[model samples]
Target: MSAPPATSPSLVLAHPTLAERKHTWTLTQPEWGTALTLEEYLHREEYLTTVPLAKHGGVTHWILTVASAPPDQRPILSSCETLRKRALYSTTAPPGGGGVAEGIAHGVGSVFTDPAYRGKGYASRMLTMVADELKAHQGTLMSPSATAASSAADDKRLPPVAFSFLFSDIGKKFYASRGWVPHPSSHLSFTTLPSRRSSTASSDAAAAAPPPVAAIGYHELAELCTRDESLLRDRMSRLPSSLEAHQAPSSFASTPPDASRPLTYVALAPDLDTMLWHLMREDFITTRLFGTTPSVRGAVFGHPGRRVWAVWTRTYQAAPPAISANTLYILRLVVEDESAGEEYLAEGLRAVIDLAREEAAEWGTAKVLLWNPDGEVEGLMRRSGLTFEAVEREKDSILSLMWYGDGPGENVVWVAGEKYTWC
Candidate 1:
């Protein structure tokens, strides 16, 4: 259906008040509450609000509604949330200047519309207003209607963000039509299967020559995440120079080098705060389901000088018939020694993946998924004797993005489109 006029008097876009917030939560529970009952889901929403990233006005809830709707009636035609996320941007040195700039990217999620309002273009109108608000904050696309809807106090508290993104569950066309172009959405999936042999003998022998994988708990991630951030910054900083040689891969800098325009690379920093937010959500669900939280946050391998590590989170679907499986996702995978030969890299990568498989089995999750594996990871799947399948996800969790304002132009490459990047 065609969206209503952008400036229609019948519709308004603004931040939801506390009551409206809870109302939207209640409205969306049946669709996204998953394994939790309504009470548990409400509590879960409360729990998430306290996380490091969600606190300090880092999250915003938005709603679209008829302006004339009565206060007694919930006027939310469509609703969604945006997370202010840390992202890195670096541009090509013009003659002799180049450095990384820290910025915020909005991670959009929990998009929902009441079933009664489905296909009425309410969501489209809501997102258009949201885009206006985001771009306005960026000091661009400041429509009078969007500006009037937001308060001056809010503008002071929240800085201009660089871009906004959402993982689309309903396929690319819908969100893409609204300016969020699709990013790479392929992932490698490994289903957990029953062990073929008795565990006693296998366990004993495995202990003797266990894979190099070592479990990393919550406390250990901060330092590593900091280090990873530095690594990511360095990679993005060098991306422009690499583009000159055509050496940078699409996963890192997908845009083709256009000499006329200075290239800019943007990447979400895989920092502790973001990782913890993902884990906090997972831990909440696991605690509700199994009465315990996962102790192994991720796995690390190799010597301290040359390490390969992976961090992951658990996804639990509503009890049976949901079609979507409960899965373990590798939120971020970092390999320190890319110069290390393919065979050596593959060995280390496979060891980490093996750890993920075992963790999935232990957690009773059906699959382990990794997004956008580079050539090296693909080599391990082919040569390491591990059974796996690659899939291009067309429906759920398709990564999508929208650049705001006069920002990084058409060639802005999104690095690190990992599971952790999702809200």
Candidate 2:
């Protein structure tokens, strides 16, 4: 687990932790913050009505507060997404924990405080409450968006991932300015898109592994209830199906865990297995990719020599041999460490692309799109004689795609693109 923030809180609530100073900071029910049940279904819609008044437009606000003594000198104010804080934490209290899946990420919004509470540490106190909830839910992965600058040295440095927006936003500035990396939303949304081609970064040996592998495994919010009940309860804050159902991963970020129905993955030998995943991540970082994810259903390792990669065929009827029938969508691309050098990376990329190409040919799919956000990756793709077309997106991301023979129509399917919120 990550370390707790420092504030020497005199009286604050947080999840029950090993730290004695920590306590459950429930916003509603005020007393026994930890034991406090849902202020109501998701959370009190206090800010939904107020954010519009703030001129921030469509902002939602919530507060998590901890009691403090006058000696503590922390103020309490309210606003959209406002928090009323007194200190970093409170004295150890009994165990109290609960949450909902949507509340984990979707519920997060801006914060506010009262004028009287300004100078006191109440804002920090309120932040502590929201922060605690975020940790408990295990939902805080920010997709850092990349800006269109030739060099990283440009005036506006792109965040490594998207969550940086949480820190960069107006209300968050007070806390984010301290040390957090502010992210631009436009950039994050772009990188979160799926990738085009994979295999360019393969190590060759792993890429060529003889297959007939079994499915890796499938997970879902429900099935996880039986497998890891504790995680489910903690993330969603309750076991009730209504709340439990929310944690399922979205098309954009994570696939919510389900049992009878769940999102799954095909297991491959270490490097080979992760080739698709790594490639997807690579494009996500570079911001030249877009696609949806499969719903709660996934295939596990089937057998040996069976390759695992996501493709979009106009229809599911396309078999391996007839895969080339549609346009091949690349959700990920492989990348190895730099020491491997230009030659190794080139051969590795071609091998993977070739593999994808063959699979596409079987399905009757044509055209491959691959984008490298990092100039270095793009340069490598170009050096290898891969045909590509450059395109810009919303000023936050860039893309260069390779078009194969016009086998599929413009309406090709995409991997993970089916899932909406995952991105």
Candidate 3:
């Protein structure tokens, strides 16, 4: 008797239909729903779809399935979402108008697979298909300069997007295998409690001293973001294009040999719209959990040319079995005076951290978290006499990036790889 071998079905990846999207949510609710009931989690997902940042097709949902599967069976095997974002690309040192171009980049998030389908390679297959769609999808909004090249179809054709990023919660190797090289994954953390004094008198005296920084609210965030973007552009303009010059050499095992293409510097601008996406999400979740929104958005110190400020958001978590505790995370920390004396700069940074601690205390968070501090910030933290823990994140929130442009991927320096950049 002869036996016949069975072939596996081909997989297809595309946008999820309305029913498929909800089905995927229902599947993942047990994993990430936390304190919310299944119904409430579903409602939150619906609300997020209508946020300003997600509108106008800025956010897209994708799913993978067996090509021959019937529609009524809910064939979704894996799913994820991509967020459209504004990015800056340049190949020149000074970055003149001709060299500077504004285009779209994407933030990947909400990756999930059916628990029953584990070890079947479905997630990897889905990511491979989504990556292609991201690179070739048309109607990408770009500046006129960015779209000036001739096209076989349209009068002007924009170049493929340069890069995309995601925060990997499962560790580095998984995403790195798929082209997302892991970046810096360190953070500075401090408890919200004030430093203990030796005596009651000393504690009272310390409490009597005025706060070192000023509180910034939601209304001021947009203006601050604009200023931050200008400064970011200026700083990146002065930076060298070579990745070796920017930081330590690549240690990622999957990074390929440097290509012959020209080196380019790309940055995801910390603009108003980007900040709003994060802030809106935080406000939505925290308001629903606590019945009120957090009032202080960030802390500021110094003035004009020499100021230092930090914008932060509160993370609300249900107690116990959830491994992550409630926290106040500094989204963006700007230290304007890189050349200032150690003593002066440290003092300003200290004030900002103190304000952050106070804000964390008010919100009942356990700690304040600052991610990927620059060399200057690290130096000041060492000398400022503030007690803190500097640790590298291994398992979660590991910043990962994948390059898709024509230029050398090794040359892409992720400027301001802070918490704000996370989707």
User: What TM-score fits each model?
Assistant: 0.86, 0.26, 0.84
Rate residue 410 of model 2 by lDDT.
15
lDDT tens readout by residue for model 3, 139-212:
32222222122222264454556678888999989998887877768889988855322233564776656455
Write down the worst ten-residue block by lDDT for model 2: 83-92
**List of clashing residue pairs for candidate 3:** none
Model 1 lDDT vs. the true structure? 0.75
In model 3, which regions exceed 4 Å deviation? 1-10, 67-72, 93-100, 138-160, 194-207, 243-263, 319-324
Q: Tell me the tens digit of each residue's lDDT in model 1 across 232-347.
A: 88777766544455443454222333555555667788999999999999999888777899898888988764788999998888543442578899999998767867777778
lDDT winner? 1
Off by over 4 Å in 2: 1-136, 139-332, 358-367, 395-422
The best candidate in terms of TM-score: 1
Model 1 backbone overlap count: 0
Model 3 quality (TM-score): 0.84
